[model samples]
Target: MIKTIKHFTISSLLYGLLFTSCDLDRLPMEGPSTGNFPANEQEAILGLNGAYQSISTLDAASTPIWHVMDNITDVGYARPGNNYTSPITSSVTTDNALATKPWQYHYRTIARVHLVLDNLSNLETSMDEGSYLQLAAELRFVRAYCYSQLIELYGNVPLLRHAVGLDNADVPRTPKAEIQQFILDEMSEIAEHLPINQSAYGHVRASRIAAYMLKARVALYAKRYAVAAEAAKKGLEYAEGIHDLTSFNATIDVAGKDHRAGEPDVSNIFGHEGYANSAEWIWVAEYSIAAGNTHNRQYYGASRLGKGVCYWGPTQNFIDSFQALDGLPIDESPLYDAQRPFENRDPRLDLYCVRPASRFMGYQFQPQTEHRTVFNYWPVNNGSSSEPSSVTNTDATNAYRSFSGYLWRKHLDLNDFNSTSVSGESELNVGIFRLAELFLIYAEAKIEANELDGSVYSAINKIRQRAHMPPLTEGLTQQQLRSALRYERKIELANDGLRWYDLRRWGIATDVMNGYLYLNRAGNGWSTNTLQYIDENHNPVYNHNEATKHFTTQTVIYKENKDEYWPIPASEMDANKQLIQNPGY
Candidate 1:
């Protein structure tokens, strides 16, 4: 007979309140003790709320640490005056303040989750078996999530399972392979007990599907192609049961009028409303300003909009990758008349970026006047105004006034009607994992496993079809298929902060990023390599015309290295002597 621990309503309420309030640092009245043991229970639910709270707060959007990583990568370029650092593209050191901060936060969250797991394992209560299993599953999910972050950023991290006291804080680093295995094992165990359907916790909480998706992601990162494919297939099974493809109009519509009418196909997985619980999303971090927590939208909003605190522009490499509307490469497509570059390009380009002189939400986006340019195609001053305002050797005749020539388009809520509105505060759930990503994962895994002629074609074809791209020709070699897969992933996941990681994992960052930089300089009458335009008066404009030089151009070679892992913060090392720095840091 299993003895059951009585459910304490008061205790549960208190825990709920603490999590709902988003405060985990507060000291409990009973100190850190797990209280009395129960007779037959193998786990306790107490302190699990703290672990869940950590997940919600550590989201990349809301946390400055995650944003720091996003800004430093090639997917987005920081403004000239911005003080941001990224370990992926630049050499980040222990002395670098931003590089060291994320290490501390991640470790702190890990410590809390470890405490919950420790207490749960020791409990002897005959508590609700279902509840105990659910709590244990959630704890494992979060622990695996923390390790995933650590593995991606630091390469190897200490895989501490027990809650350590101050005296036992010094723990040695675990090997990267071992750490990844540990995470996979934990997620696999959790998946067995996690619920498959939506419940009281909502879509923001981890379900069995989320665990499987995470397993797939971690396996792919570790280059375990077979395991990745299996995990992705499992996740897709659940994802397919839930979401259908949203229509192109709904995906690109700023008004969201179709979405508001309860039209399922009109909502994206990332929209603020309508699709929060849609089948597309396997996991999301929920946010509401009324809850005293907000998602990170300030990074991309207009400066006139109160939250536009950071301006990380897009790169020329990204802009050039978008295929023409007819599915031909920009360089290959005859419709790609260099003079009018924006016309007839992939629809995603217009949906994902706000280019200079482009219309978004009925307002003209003039980069020179507002410093809201989309990509880094113009000259950027390094701390001083002494550098030439125009890019050297590039025609100043077609220069735009802004330093970065592109603005972020994804996740920006245009339907809010107010230019100054903070779209980040909306109740929309921020998707951490989605089905479309799973499809890409399956496609990549199959390609890597030398199964390109098998199911890989179907998976890749689905994504290409959505992008309106033609099917990849049959009989291509593995290397050719790999190239195609890489291109597909880039365009499909552009502006979603996946490019930097993908490039690093594929070991192609240097080759892809090292090249001449160019921007569409048509606005200022400067010819970007001899393209011409005309004014409303029908006057033929030369590359030197005022309209031609309005576009800006900035180009520089990027230095990259295998020292891709960020250095564990010196502060953490000082506190935990067992933590080792990654190689070449």
Candidate 2:
């Protein structure tokens, strides 16, 4: 087992409590202060672990914040509530927990990092030079990561380089560009302090390659395409033999007797097993029941029939985004049949989501009422003498099940199925950075820069080959290549917490989100002409008149300037007078 520095020890908890009394700017008046703590190498490591504990706090809800983030975007939907529905519909308030938590938690992490950095130099004489520098670099990476998330979500935020007392706590919001530059510069400076590969350390800690990938991502988000491509190239060079894509785990047939070669199963990559033995993962946030750091991932992602409430799921728009087997979109492909939609689509559609009539966990997952009972496939696999029997399909009958009529199977694990219950928590590690995402980043940055070449095609084809899809055709224009790149990112990275950022960065959220979000709880087929076309951004466009006749519709609105970024929390504004809220709040 890998010994990750993610344990929520007593000292880490106490350090977290020190910043709980106020917002990011204030320090604790009655707890362990930085002055008397982290006085040695052991305490320094403990303090660093405290900084890492903020990652667990991100799972403030039923699932990690990253998994829940896509629910508010165009691709996924959450259980209906103000917190989930209001953001996508442009009615969210400054006091909403979803909007406030990101601001609060990210700043709290930044403060904790500053606390450790402020006193880390005291033990330099006792520790080796390389160890001391590596410790500082790791802490800086954590701070830079927090700022990266903040600038993406909230735009401009207060940038504090060091720990501050109450007198100097209030600071004005810095321009997002400056902070982006600071992140780029800091990542460049600290990349050498970290190791190139941390496989011996369980791939949980930040490595030199991970820092370059972060730099590339930040630069791409800022539209610095050349810089992004260069950083990505460096990262890929370092990761040549160290990291690559992991093949999907084989899926068992319904009889539990045969394994299918065509079916794609990602349980080994995104599930608990991936944390232990996945080469594709570059940096991870590890969770362990043994260390008392975990979240209810399977509890939120599994279906009601599988002992989960099904709090989040994919939207109909997302389901239609997958291409036909021929690598052409459903609307343009001759292989597509509206009546047999699930048969000839990309394998990832089934790999990532559980639609009606699909086998999930141990039962046939039919979310429509027509299927009263589904065949149970677990008994035979578990060595029971009794044959498989029909069981109540609670997923179809439960009032609070998935609103979109689909459930996520991406990060869920079959090994945890028997253990899943209302009270069960999952220790599956969440990926922070992975090799597949890095490849997509390189391809996208190169495409945007109009630097298309064999390398770009190789980067994209590697991902497609892994998914059993055809590679991009030769002699395509830059516009067509952009669409292809967008398609890859939308499908390959769906529900991985990056769609909302992609929509805004691509300037298509307003166009795609203002319309109605479609659903098909009955799993009914549509007319051949129901889908108008696939848009340039790879979003499926539907004919409204024909769509509502067969599918359920939900209204969504996105304001041009306002919904692009969330409002600064009301508490932060009241606590710091210098903080100016984002525009149109």
Candidate 3:
């Protein structure tokens, strides 16, 4: 919530109260140090903003945050240069910075929320009682949102719904089942007091849709499929009026896809100009170019543009996760031709990554060319160091950049590469939730609940139609539908910081992230194939000896129950003696 802390007058006065870690044993008889603040409407509004500021404690483009969230799952692989082997291999210790960050930021936000809620009984405002109730509901929504993530990440975390002083801070960890119910109950109960819509673009506030979104996600995580289904249905009803999926259907002339996809599908949703004022974003975090956003995601996600560290590389497993146009994996689908791997694949694969031989930002990406710059054309406006960004592993570039054979294109701003200073100033908001996500949630929840009715099919088809993929067959068993739903959710939500959470919730992280995450090939099976060249649109031509070659990559071990929950930060337990670490931590 410190993202917008300047608007709040109490920031300077309550700095320690807002940022300091809480002690849980008891509350002193004396009152809160800053109890006198938040006495008026202006102060109340500022306090609410203070509570919301922690949402951006980790930026959309932050490497550390993304490394812990995405790399540990099946969808992402971080550059090995950072030396974060603990998280990469699923053996992270309690003292890891990754463990400390969510603990600090989430609880810090919860503390702010408690401050606002505790003052709710005393504030006098010009707005009606309904308006005050709406504000109260929003504060609770923020608190519930943080708790939802906390319980999932570190099960049995202390649930501090109210302001706690040093003397009263040492509370025992609440069971996840109970914490999950609390979140569901709070969101559903407060949802009625909230309006259907709030006119804000920067994700500065919450609405009824956010309440239902949280309810659906948390309920699903708790395996309360019925509640998840109902909440998703209600959320869909509210979202239908304001947002529609972006499309890239060149064959069909639809309202949203009235033009080319590069503009609407790719640009508007993730790029600079589009994120500046996008309709697809449901809940987002705002940043200022003047004050500077936290990180340059465009630089990290890129292979040729901007800073071009390309901090991550997509695993071959993730590449294969995408279904072919025939809605099947490459091994099963008839449309999939090994000679033409990129062709006949899902458009999302092309849109979300700079795939082999694909045209990108007015140039072609040819990783097999053996040139420093993989792209046929490089933007020279930005300062250069004689060699292209492709020449990584040198003095100016990182050795692990894009070593995984693919780069992320989903959350990056394509236009932020104008210059050194401007390139690092991408203010693209991180969408906390999106309309497409709600659709998938509703579809999956309904499927799991054995209610494969017309509505379920309709909801899924809307998402599929946007991606220009084929629909589900006429009849599929519950098990079959479950399979379909699983892949759909994975592909649609990849790299948006939801993959790890989704895998853990579905109990599939152990299966998916079990082994090698393919980055780039250098020896044994890959070198011989580089000699044969093909056109950008052509499939790779392998020699007779190299035809049976298999690529080499890195390995990761997901420790089943052990890795499902992160450890409580060592410092947190030191501060509160009553706290116990999660199992196997």
Candidate 4:
């Protein structure tokens, strides 16, 4: 019943800005009525497309919105230069721009769907029921998605089922539990009508599996473990046939000036080009040079393979979360070497970050080293085995040249063209939903339900095997499996912008991120408090011969919140007297 026609024609429209005329202040004294729009199926498709447009705001490569999700978590650190320190370690307020923007954007998306939904009742011409159901399901799916995000971010939010007029629009907040049930029910009703597969790339139309996935994720967040487990299982029924953990290695040119093979695990799974219309993609935020953050994503967090702000970096705590290839933590495994911290870690860790001496984009990035004369190890009498680097502090703000010293490597465009800056036409894409995530969902839900069957082990191991890590120990207890699930999600889904939510869903944000996050700094020829590297007692001087001042810890404290939700935008509270702010705002 889902419409095969995809894509919106109304590209000019943006977050809640309806343009009546080209003139800024001038309105036509008399304009065509709303009745004139979408008289046929072709036009209705455009209206549906317009509803889907708001999703672009969620793309990390395009906007600053994702910074909220990435920075507020324990896994990542916000660059101090952009002044994102507040989101990371300060008290978040209702006036926070990150809190307000997502509210406006999601509602704007919801409102667009309301247009199609509201007009469906007034359609003058006859339309097929199958076609009508398909259109209706698509809108409902989008609406549910927006509400789901609102529920995750704000907790209790107004569920606007249909479009509202500009005047008389004060709506009260609905309890989150009620909204959660409503979404599950609504998706169940629409599942029979949606397509089994989306007809085109970047389209918002859901297949039955997408609906199940949404339900599974929502139920998991809702803590309906049994419901989540069953829904995830059903989702896998549709997923297993169409998508697999398998990936292909293609020799693609980097901006046609350099050549590199796709990363074995994740590189091929993401990005707009090369993988377009690939079966593994369940949902994505599609964009073009016409409308995308090709420049913005490159500007921040991306590697210096292109010019970037390096506005964010991962913490040493997150880096340590990766297990050795032998399926043991660095502390447990004999492979770990304190002198060379990044070596022999999980392969994905290197793929996802620009660590001390890792290679990427034809450059050996060393963020923790001092200037050229400085090597990480003592190279003279008591020297290090590590090689030296010309590029010290590779991941840092250009203004300050200081950072947490780790850079996120996922979704970065490393071609020669964007090697220093984006052309505003970068072809990177955002993955909204993928099969690998579903596997985790199923595994996590099963663990939560205390039902660690063979399927649970199979699901979790598929992702582990792809990353080329050893399989988990078989026949583990439920508690042990839960621990395994936590690590799997952390390493597998790092920097994909989901860890923040995971911290909340697992009810461990306070325990995991509350205290000081330790960042280890080590370099040769540096002075220390213990005078190990210092030769003088009163006037401290470095030996410059020993790897002294070896490693020091920097702390960033994350406060535990009374409630898991972010504050509702202060402006919304002021505008709507009936609206209540979330706890601890």
RMSD to the true structure for each prediction, in A, is 10.6, 3.0, 6.7, 8.8
Clashes (N, CA, C under 3 Å) per candidate: 40, 0, 16, 5
State the lDDT of candidate 4 residue by residue for 363-476, as single tens digits: 444454343322222122134434433434443324433255666766654542233465444435566677878899999888988887899999898888777678888889
TM-score (C-alpha) between model 1 and the true structure: 0.77
How many pairs in model 1 have backbone atoms within 3 A of each other, for residues 3 or more apart or on separate chains, i.e. clashes? Answer: 40
TM value for model 3: 0.84
lDDT of 3 by residue, 417-519 (tens): 4532434544555667788888888888888889888887787777787788898886888887777777777777777778878777777667655655554
Give me the displacement of residue 235 in model 1, in angstroms: 1.8
What would the TM-scores of all predictions be? 0.77, 0.94, 0.84, 0.82
Error of 4 at 413 (Å): 2.5
Sort the candidates on lDDT, descending order: 2, 3, 4, 1
By lDDT, who's the top model here? 2
Q: Compute the lDDT of residue 149 as modeled in candidate 2.
A: 93
TM-score of 2: 0.94
Minimal lDDT window, size 10, model 2: 252-261
Candidate 2 local lDDT, 1-585, one digit each (tens) = 222344344655555465445344342211224575577887777667766767656864668888988989888998888998899889989998898888877777777777678888888899999999999999999989989999999998888888766677688899999999999999999999999998876676789999999999999999999999999999999999999898765652221111121223576788766767789999887676655667888888888878888888999999999998799988899988887787677778888888777777777787778878887777765878466678998888888878898888888887787777888977777888999899999999999999889888999889888887899998888999999899999888987899999999999988989989998766667898789998887788999999988899889999997888899989878877888888777
